[model samples]
Target: MQTRNRVAMSRRAFAGSLGALVLCAPAVARAQSSGVVRRNTSGFKLHNWQDHFDELGKGIIISDTNSRVMQQWMPGGEMFIYPTSVPMTDELTRRGYTEITFKDPAPDWTPTPSMRERDPSLPAYMPPGPDNPLGARAMHLSWQYYRIHGTHDTRKIGRRSSSGCIGLYNEHIIEVYDRTPVGTQVKLI
Candidate 1:
């Protein structure tokens, strides 16, 4: 009789667990469909240079805000892609054509007027160092106060966290800064 009771209890426990799974299946499916579930590193979409550029003039750099990825295409069909941190909001984003006006290997930081307006406590200027927000390198764009630079804060990558600049990892920015020259065509979309 004890053996029969034990078997019955085991079957009851299994049935309860199966029923709970069935009840939760719809919610789990809904969460996945709604994008609550995400995979790391596979979210970026590869883009064709021809689709966005007339030609790779001085090579081209494309920063896609939606995917949080940046692509660099060299003249000889060489291409490199890096995850980036985009502007925090649509209002802060500046899209369309621009070019690299300058490249700074050891960049200083000066908060823009708007940046200062947003945060009054920001310093008037910052010298280059690990603590500087521009990290190890910076590529200035034609647009005022905009840049493609590195961040000491690695958590910012693959997220919408920047004020207006496109941000990369420190090591990645060093590589990009070395490869990209002044006057390289750029587009943020």
Candidate 2:
């Protein structure tokens, strides 16, 4: 009987301590872990894009570089530019996209090695570098081969000069690299 009483007391104490810790935790930690952001850099800093977030639903990704924006529509063949995002990392995991042939409609699922073979000049497929075609990070949409990647070409920051790929700046690419994870949704306009 005494053992049973002690066990009950211990359980109550544990519960009370857990409740206290929970209450003391920061609100940011409580935010959804579903988001992914750039890793190598310091904390991602972002500002609102003035556009209403309510109208957007497919998915939202902030630029990982400095202040810049590049939005593109897959089927519609249009890219909208605005200073909507800054170099802010998100804890966002996006849809899986392995680099394969750069087809408009991504080809069958394959590992991201074929891309390196296809563009042998684009440096070896390293994780985070100026030449890595995957850019600092890639936000994979439901689409197969397609991805929103950063570019070594600082000049292409606001250009739609990819074979159906969305190009981001280099530093911004790193910012995206830090935050994005494996299975996040991408709603490119």
Candidate 3:
């Protein structure tokens, strides 16, 4: 009876350790994949390359795939980072550089002919409202069929879910929309 109890305790201990390792695997893999090592320090910390922060702007959007976040740079180095939805394939968001061409409030959604052809189930047009995928506000990008817009499904804000569009929470969109103007530069890497 003593030997059996010892064996059971050992098994439980091993299982707990295994579970801990499994829970940490994703974070470990993400760090490995990005080649970014985060450390605690008391002094100055060097972030990304200096060139990435060289430019000054009132309207610049930087989308980082590895971190799954978007940083909006306002003039004088005011930066706001928000979680973003990204394309499944990097190719869609990898367009070297682009800019916001226009913006709309409660924008009506119309499926591009190509999108309609690709997804036969998609509606030809969806009026501006709750059912519209482009939630409360939208910023049309120079690239075809892509927009920085509010998403009805806030659950997808930090995930790789959109075809190519950059999605923000509805309230977040309203804040950004009020600040950003047409022709704001957008960089997705």
Task: Tell me the deviation in Å of residue 31 in model 2.
Answer: 22
lDDT of 3 by residue, 73-155 (tens): 66654555566777767755555578889999988998777567768899889999998989999999888888889988988
The sequence of per-residue lDDT tens digits that candidate 2 reaches over residues 28-106 is: 3424333322222224244332242332233344332333343321222222222222211222222222222221211
Task: Score residue 103 of candidate 2 by CA lDDT.
Answer: 16
Please give the ranking of all candidate structures by TM-score, highest first, separated by commas.
1, 3, 2
Clashes of each: 0, 20, 0
Residue 93 CA displacement from its true place in model 2, Å:
22
lDDT (Cα) of model 1 = 0.88
lDDT by residue for model 1 (45-157), tens: 77888998889878999999999989888887777778899999999999999999999989999999999999999999999998999999999999999999999999999
TM-score of 2: 0.36
Q: What would you estimate as the lDDT of candidate 2?
A: 0.41
Displacement of the residue 73 alpha carbon in candidate 3, Å: 1.1
Candidate that beats the other on lDDT, 2 or 3, i.e. the better one: 3
The lDDT of each candidate is 0.88, 0.41, 0.73
